[model samples]
Target: MHKTRIGRDGPNVSVLALGGASLGGVYQDVSQGEADAVVQAALDAGINLIDVAPYYGLTRAETALGAALKGVPRSDFVLMTKVGRYGDKTWNFSREATLRSLDESRARLGVDYIDVLQCHDIEHGDRRQLIEEALPTLRDLKGQGAIGRIGITGYDLSVLEDVATTEQVDTVMAYCTYSLQDRRLAGVAQRLGRSGVAVFNASPLGMGLLTSKGPPDWHPGHPSVWAAAAEAARRCEALGVDLSFVALQFALQTAAANGIVSTVVGMSKPSNLDRNIEALTTPIDPAVLTAVEAALAPVRDKGWDVLPGGGGKAGK
Candidate 1:
């Protein structure tokens, strides 16, 4: 396990962060006990950062994470969660709602204060209002010692750039935006890096497309999953490297990516955690990188109908 600096001047954190979305039951159905076990495994593996959101399984994920952190010392790990979206699928950035959301998250995670509190999925026009309303609330929370740092999570590079340039957010959790398949945020990462905002690259596997297993036909809501898998398969064949390993390594090796933050990919079994951990440590060759880029040229040229900020459309 390696550690990376969070913000330019922030605390050190594990190079790989455990994403709590899967623990809440979006990608695969996982029970509380199973989720807790997964969290425990991540901790044992020396992972320190865990990212979750209220939008994931409507707070179920946070609750499961809370249960998992019961015995762990608060100082040993960095806990992060998001506001903006509620369990009922509504986006609210009101002052009251933001404060209430933090309080609820603290209660659910059983933490005195969150290490990082982010605004979830803020986009185009919504960015200004969210900043105006939500950011002030978060700043107040930081003042009150309710959170250690502030952040915003979404796919919009411009908004993130604005936030990173203007605000004092310690981190930015940007998902599926700057993977090998999508490089829209490459410049954003550089800008934020210079600005001292830690950038956590989320969905590094493109939501399971870059794994060894080919994308299934029936994966709900994620049409790009299949396309990404096919592209990864072609790359694997050309590069003579396992697709899953390449995907994971590509993210880890990306110049703009500070660290890879992804859910414990458990579509099939628990052993997948070991496999992912192995991929993180495995060394990749330069020839393999060239082959992968060549194989992915077509998909890259096609340009996925990705959201402007890098998130897929709703129900995509």
Candidate 2:
């Protein structure tokens, strides 16, 4: 894995960062052994960035990741986690809540300091509260050496842009926005880059929509979008290729070309890490990619405003 500087003057991180969602069993049941293996594999492979959040599995991710990283030298990876949005509908961005969340996360992750402390899903919290209370509190923590940098993550690009441009943020993470079916985040990442805000592209698989198994039933994409993804997956399978490989390849390549710093994906086991590593190292077949893109054209750039399982609108 190759490393790049985050923001204009932030820490250097690998381009293919490992996400902690799978460690928490977000997609399926994962054993403690699997979590340990994946974390070690990522570190050995030079993947220096590991992203997680308290909301992922309701603090399970942080707990699992903390155990996985127990013996490993902390300097081996850049640890990142988020505040607010503790559960499906729980959101608190107040000053006191933010501080308490940090302490709880630190204890859960067994870390003395975090590399990047982000405001998770800012669009879900009161916008004024985030700008007026949460963000300022993070800055204070940074000054005190509890956190290294400040960042924000959300599903909506406009809200991410609004906060990143107006606030003193070092990075912005937008999930499912820069995948094969959607390229909206590329433009937003470029715009944010101008201001020295490093952009992270999470869920390059479109939260499972691009996978061969198809998205989870809770995915909020429109019916048409799901149909198109299903068709694309069929075509890929017919051609004896994995749709996820093409999606990951396209996302990593396109993100790099557009100035995006990293692409985060969930990997709970070593086999999962191996497949993703292959996607990063292998050369994409132009003909196969062309076919996949054509199959996905019907829903290109289409998305929903609501989070997964929220039954949000089909179009933004």
Candidate 3:
């Protein structure tokens, strides 16, 4: 597996990162043993970066991850997590809360320090306070050896840019806007990646909207969007390819072309992890790409509301 640097000079993270949402069982319940197997699969496959948050399974994900890493050398992997949110669905960016959250994360993960600590979902809070309090608090933690790299993750691109230009975060994570259907981040990702703030492009499946089976009930895509997606899947099926394969590949390839640092994906089962690795290892057929594009042309960029920094708001 290849690697990419976070921001200007942060630690080297694998090109493929394992997102912890599924480990937390966001879509479906995952057993501890199953989660452990998936993590092991990631390590065995040479994947080095693991991103998780308290928001994922409300701390269940971190617990599983920490357990999975119990026997592994700390230096062998890059662990990224977040602070600034409480388990009770409340926002707390105060310095005291920040410290407490970090401590909780450390305790849960059974780690001395987190490699990358970001303010998770900054867009949901008062942007001013998050920028003024949470972000700086992260820097202070970095100074105090509690965290390594500082980062910000959100669905608001403009707010991210606000943090990027004005603050000192080492990386920024944006989701769901750089996939095959939405190239909203195209122009700026290269520039940001060149400038040294690693642009982590995640959510390549757009929360399962791009898959052959379609999204969960809570998804906000218009019904026609699903129809269009189904048509795209049929087109891929005609060519003996899965639409999911095309979606993930297009997301990865798009990230590469835009100079984005990494593409993150999540899976609760080992089978899912193996499938993604195969997708990454295989070359995407240009013919399939063309057909998939044509089939999805009507609904490309159709699902979410775009934010300023190339982040996306789910269509409601």
- Model 2 worst lDDT window (10 residues): 307-316
Quote model 2's TM-score.
Answer: 0.96
Candidate 1's error at 226, in angstroms? Answer: 5.4
Candidate 3 lDDT, 1-316, residue by residue in tens = 8887776667878888999988887779998999889999898888999999987888899998888888899988999998876553467777787888888889989999899898877777667778778878888878899888888887667777677767856788888767877666666577667667778888888777788887776665567776777888888888887888888887776577787888889878889888888778788889999988887788777645421222223211
Clashing pairs in 3: 7-196, 7-198, 8-196, 157-309, 158-309
Candidate topping lDDT: 2
Give candidate 3's error at residue 107 in angstroms. 0.4
Q: Estimate each model's TM-score.
A: 0.85, 0.96, 0.92
Q: What is candidate 3's CA lDDT for residue 142?
A: 84
Whichever of 1 and 2 has more TM-score, that candidate is: 2
RMSD of 3: 3.0
The local lDDT score (0 to 100) that residue 190 gets in candidate 2 is 90
RMSD of 1: 3.7
lDDT of each: 0.70, 0.88, 0.79
Residue 240, model 1: Cα distance from true site in angstroms: 6.4
Check candidate 1 and list the clashing pairs. Answer: 155-309, 156-309, 221-316
